[model samples]
Target: MFCNKMLELQRVYRQASLLALITIYYNLLEGAVSVWFGAGDETISLFGFGIDSFVEVISGVGIWHMVRRLGRGETADRDPFERQALRITGGAFYLLTAGLIATASASLFQGHQPQTTRWGIVISLISIVSMQALIHFKTKVGTALNSPAILADAACTRTCLRLSVVLLAASLGFQLTGIGSLDAVGSLIIAVLSFWEGREAFEKARGLGCGCSCGCTTSTKSDH
Candidate 1:
């Protein structure tokens, strides 16, 4: 029975690692396209959103590394490595928040109106669908694996979904109403949320004495 359980865990960890890699690839493509169009069209919101995608790619990599350790039969609560990974993910989120804020503020100050680009709208719609599906699968796998890092990774994807909605709204609004400031405003909102998420991750890391992702203080807690 013990051997069966270990095999099951190994299988799930492999799946989680594959999902993380897929996320990295998707975000890389998405970020490249977004940055290209965003820069060409001078859309601050779109550019900031692209930058966020790249940051998410880093977070995915961190999670993938941690899960791979588990796949190698390493203990999940290994303090040195797990804590380092958590801190890396947390710091990346904070950096993303700062970048978004700075970009949005500069755009607002300059009164730079984002030119309507149909590509922004299309990309955001695709992101919404893709992120939602990822959220579902990540949630399932994270729960089965009982991994806090993986679950936190899923939460990040949820934030990406929200950002996509904001991007779509800003893009469509600019296209229809010709309002330039709305794009900056959307980016500002995303910045605030990113900061909040970063803070939450940091707090979780600090509270994790056992280095498990879920923050259970005792062995009685489910490590599933």
Candidate 2:
């Protein structure tokens, strides 16, 4: 029974690690594609969304490290490496927020429109489906392991899901209505959410909860 239990736990840990890696790689691909098309098409929202994915890669690294430690049965406390990664991720998110806000405001002021939002429509749909699947699996694995860090990571993915929805709506709205400001409007919304994410990252670095509904904060407290 003991050996079987250990084997089962090992399997869960491997799944968690694989999920983390998938997230990192997927973000890299998504970020590259999004930035390339966003820049070519001059779509602020898609551009900003791409930047967000890059930042997420940094955070995913920390999660990957944590999963490795947990697999070894190490203490679940926030390690220095994870803390530093969170700090860097937080700063990157803040910078992204500022840049997006500035560009979006300018675009709004000038009534600038993208050449076409067709790519945004396609990319956002893909992101929406991908993020949803990631969230479900991450949450499931986190539950199996009872790991707050993993659960919080799942919650963070929810932000990506929301961003995808915003992009999709703005892209579709513009395609249907020929409104130039919808894309900028979507960028502004993404900026706001990015700011919130930045704050959450900092909070996590400081040993506080991410303030998401995932109950990670409560779980962290209980662990102590």
Candidate 3:
């Protein structure tokens, strides 16, 4: 049983590492594409895709921090304060999501169609799948490990999965209905969802002793 558990941890760690590396590379590629297609084409979807890539990059960085903490045998020693900080960061990430959605909506209203390059839809699909996998793994780790940072990471991936739904809508609406407004409306919906997630993250962080003295400087058990 002990061996099995150890193997599971090793597997999870490997998966996390793969995700971190890929997300960073993906962000660079996406940002370049978005910038190149910024004008005279998809002013919103392309730009929004770039923004989403950055968000993933942030998540990758956060995960890297947590991974190092785990390596140093410090995860177990993390305090409530650190946990609250993670929550705050999570809240900020979602708030940025709201801003991205707003920008996407505004662009759509201005009738901006993404140039539909070879990479846009394909990469988006791959990202959607990757995020879903991350969400599942992170949520499980957070619950078992009692790690707020892990939980927040899971939540961000969940948000990404939800936003991908809107992207799918944009694809379909463009192909079927030919109504550009559908894409705009989808962006609005995603923005509203982002706001809700942001508020949720803030509340969760507060519950973990944010803006209060909970003496979060010490942990007896392992955070991993």
Task: Estimate the TM-score of every prediction.
Answer: 0.81, 0.94, 0.62
Q: Name the lDDT of candidate 1.
A: 0.74
**Model 3 residue 189 lDDT score:** 65
Q: Write the per-residue lDDT of candidate 2 for residues 87-192, one digit (tens) a residue.
A: 9988998999999999999999998999889999999999999999999998898888777767877887888899899999998989999898999999999898
Best of the two (1, 2) by lDDT: 2
lDDT of 3 by residue, 1-224 (tens): 99897777766665555555655676667657654663335535445655555554544554555555664446433345544554655665576677767676576667755454334355457668877776677667656655555455565566667666666666556656666665566556655655555554455444532211112222224456
> Model 1: clashing residue pairs?
none
lDDT of each: 0.74, 0.86, 0.55
Model 1 regions lying over 4 Å from their true place: 1-8, 78-82, 146-149, 204-222
Error of 1 at 32 (Å): 1.7
In model 1, state the lDDT of residue 49. 81
Tens-digit lDDT track of model 1 for 3-65: 999888888888888888988899999999999998999887788788778766765665677
Model 2 gets an lDDT of 0.86
